[model samples]
Target: MQTTSHILMIRPVQFGFNAQTAVNNAFQQVNNETGVQEKAQQEFDRFVALLRGHGVDVTVIDDTPQPHTPDSIFPNNWISFHHDGSVILYPMFAENRRLERKPHIIGKIAEQFRIGRTTDLSDFEAKNLYLEGTGSMVLDRTHKVAYACLSPRTHPEVLKAFADATGYETVEFHAADAQGVAIYHTNVLMCIGDDYAVICLDAIPSKEERKYVEEKLKGSRKTVIAITLDQMNHFAGNMLQVQSLRGRKLLVMSTQAFSSLTPGQITELSSFNPIVHAPLDVIEKNGGGSARCMMAEIHLPGKG
Candidate 1:
C-alpha cells in the first residue's frame, strides 16, 4: 500500500532546539527560551488532535525526561516500521539523538503489530556513517524506490545497505539550498506520495541529476509537483499522504507549508487528497522538522 493509517509520534518532554542538528539543519532558528517547551508541547498536542480528527490513527509515545532527547519528537529519524512485519533501526548522526531509539518503544508496538525480524543498521554509526531513517530517504513504497540526497547524515554505503536489505532501488542525488550548503534531510526537500511527488528540483543544481530524478518519478507514473526553492524554504515539499480510517486520502503538512503552495499546486494536490494542516511555527523553528518529519508511518499488519 502507498499510504498507511497508523502513524507513530513522540511527545516531547523537554522539547527545545538542539545544536547538534542545527549544524546542518538551516531551517532551525533558536528563539527566546521562555516557554519554548510549553509552546512546543501545545503545538504537538494540537497536531496530534488534528491528525486524529482527520481519522488518522496515531500512536503517541511520551519522551522520558531522564534521557533528555530534545529531538525525540521526530521519531521517523531513528526507526521505521514496514508492512512485511519488519522494523528497521537507523544510524543517527547526533549522539543524543541516538537515545531516541528505545527498545521498549518497539516492544510496546509489537503488542499491537506483528513485528518480524529487525534490521539493525545502527552499527554503522561506529564507523562514522549514518542514515537517519526516513529523514535520509523519501520512499516511494509502492514502486520500491528510495530517493536520497547525499549528505553527512545520509551516507551512500548505508543507504545502499538499506536498499539491499529492503529490496528497494536507490535513486541517489545531491541537493542543496540556495547558499550551496547541502540540505540536512531529503524529507525536507521532497516527498513521494501514492500517485504524486512534491520536489524542489532547484535544489538538485545539476541538470543531469535533476533530469534523472524527474525521469525516475515520471517512469514510476508519479505526477511531479515541483516546488521552487523559496517554497521549499517554507517546507512546501515536506508533505505526507496518509489513509484515514475510512480509507480517505489526506495530505498532512504544516500550515506554513500549505500557505506557501501556489493555487495551481494546491488544486493539483487536492485533486488527489484533501489537505490537512496545523500551526507548527514553534516546532518547525526549534525542531527543524515539520509535520512529515514528526510522523513515522506504521505499515505493519495487526497481530491478528
Candidate 2:
C-alpha cells in the first residue's frame, strides 16, 4: 500500500535551530534561542492531537537529552519502516542527527510490530557519504519507485545501496531553488502520494530532467499537481498521504504549506484525499522541516 495508518513521531526534547544542519538546509532560519524549545513542544503536541483527531495512529516517543540531538524532532531522516518488515537505517548528513537512532527506540517499536532483517547504512557516514532516509528520497511505495534529487546529503553510492536492499528502482535528478542553490532534500521539492504527486517542476533546471520526472509520474498514472518555486520555499511540496484507521485517505501537511497552495492545487489534491494540516511555524522556522519530516510512517505489520 502507498499509505499507512501508523506514524512515528519523536517529541521534541531539544528542538531548536541546528547550526550543523543549517549549513546546508536553506529553509532554516535562526530564531531567539530562549523559549524556542518550549514553543516547539507546544506545536508538536498540537500537531499530534490534530492527527489523532483524524484517526491516524501516531506513536509519540520522547527524545532523550543525553545525546542532545537538536534535530531529533525530524525522525524520518534517520530511519524508515517498510511494509515488508524491513527496517532500513540511513546515514544522516549532520553528525548530531545520526545520534537520533537509538537501540531503545527500535526495541520500543518492536514491541508492537514485527521487524524483519535490518539494513544499517550508517557506516557510510564515516566516508561522508550520506543519504538521510526518506528525506533524501521521496518514495512511491505503490510503484516501487524512489525519486531522489541529488545533493551533498544524497550520494549516488548510498542511493544504490538502498535500491539494492529494497529492490526499489531509483529515478535520480537534480533540483535547485530560484537562487540556484541546490535543495537540501528531495521532499522539499516533491511528494509522491498514492494517486497524485505534488511537485515543483520548475525546480529542475534542466528541461530534460523535468520532462523525465513528469513522464515518470504520468507513467505511474499519478495526477501531477505542480507548485511554483515560491510555494516550494514554503514547504508546500513536503506533504505526505496517509491512511486513516477508518480507511480514509488523508493528505498531511503544515499550515504554511497548506496556505501556499493555489485553489486549483488544493482542489485537485482534495479530489483524491481530504487534507489534514496543523500550524508548525515554530518547528519549520527552527528545524527546517514540517509535518512530513516529523512523521516516520510505520509500515511494519503488527504482531498480534
Candidate 3:
C-alpha cells in the first residue's frame, strides 16, 4: 500500500499557545488576546472531516482533561508505529508533552494490528537529549532513509539510535529559522514523499550540506520540489503525501500552506499528486505546526 487508510490525530482540549515549546519553536505565537482555542478546535474538526471525506480513515482521540499538554495536538511526536511490528517511543523536548504517550492508545491499535516489540527511547530525556519522533525525522520508507535536521530539540544521539533500531540511513543536516536559530523540527523545513521531496534549500546555510541533500534526493529518483524560506515559513514544506482508500495519492497540507503556493508551483506539484488542505490558522499560530504535525500515519500491517 502506498499509504495507510488509518491516521491518528489528537483533538486539543486545552488548545492554546504553548509556552514550553515556544522556547525552541519560533513559529509559535507568544501572546494572543483573542480566544483562539475554539477556532483551533473547529479547524481540527474540519480537517478530520475533510480527510474522512477523501476516504482517508482517521482515528480522532480527545486529549486528557487534566495535566494539560498544550502540544499534545501533534501526536506524531510522542510515538511512531512501524510495519515491522516495532513501536518507537520518542523523548520529547517539552516536559508536558511527555504525557501524551498513553499505553491505551497502543492497546487500541493492537486490536487491528500486530504488536512485535516496543522501544522506549525516553531515557535520553534524562540526559537532556531529545528526538520528537516523526517531527524530528521524516522517513523515506521506500528507500529506508531518515532525513533530519539538527536542532536543540533533536539530538544526534537519538537520531543515530533510531537509525540503528529502524535500519534506516540517516541523512542529517543543519537547519535554521529566519532569525538564524536552529529549526526545532525536521518536518517544518521539509517532507519526503514517495517519489518527490519538498524542501527549503535556503534553510541549509552550508553549500556542501545543501549539495549533498540535493544529490541524495536525485540519486533516489525523486523530483526535488524546492520551496523558498518564505514559503517554508508559511508551512509549504510541511506537506505529506498519503494514499486514499481508492489507492490514489493525496498531497496533504494546511490551507495556509496551500495559499502560499504560486500557480506554477501548484501546477508542478499537481503533476505528482492531488492536493488536500484544511484551514489551520489557529493551530498553526498557537501550536506552531501544520497539517503534517497533526497526523501520525499507522504503518502497522493490518488484519486481512
TM-score of each model, paired residue for residue: 0.99, 0.99, 0.97
- Per-candidate RMSD vs. true structure? 0.7, 0.7, 1.1
The CA lDDT at 53 in model 1 is 96
Cα lDDT of candidate 2 equals: 0.93
- After superposition, the stretches of candidate 2 with alpha carbons farther than 4 Å from their true spots are none
Q: Please write out the lDDT profile of model 2 over residues 1-304, one tens digit for every residue.
A: 9999999999988888999999999999976667999999999999999999999999999989888999988989999999989999999888888888988889889999999999999999999999998999999999999999999999999999999999999999999999999999999889888888999999999999999999999999999999999999999998999988998999999999999998988888999999999999989999888889999999999999
Which clashing pairs does model 3 show? none
Reference-based lDDT, each prediction? 0.93, 0.93, 0.88
Local lDDT at 58 for model 2: 94
- Model 3, stretches more than 4 Å misplaced? none
Clashes of 2: 0
Q: Going through the candidates in order, what is the number of backbone clashes in each?
A: 0, 0, 0
Better of 2 and 3 by TM-score: 2
lDDT of 3: 0.88
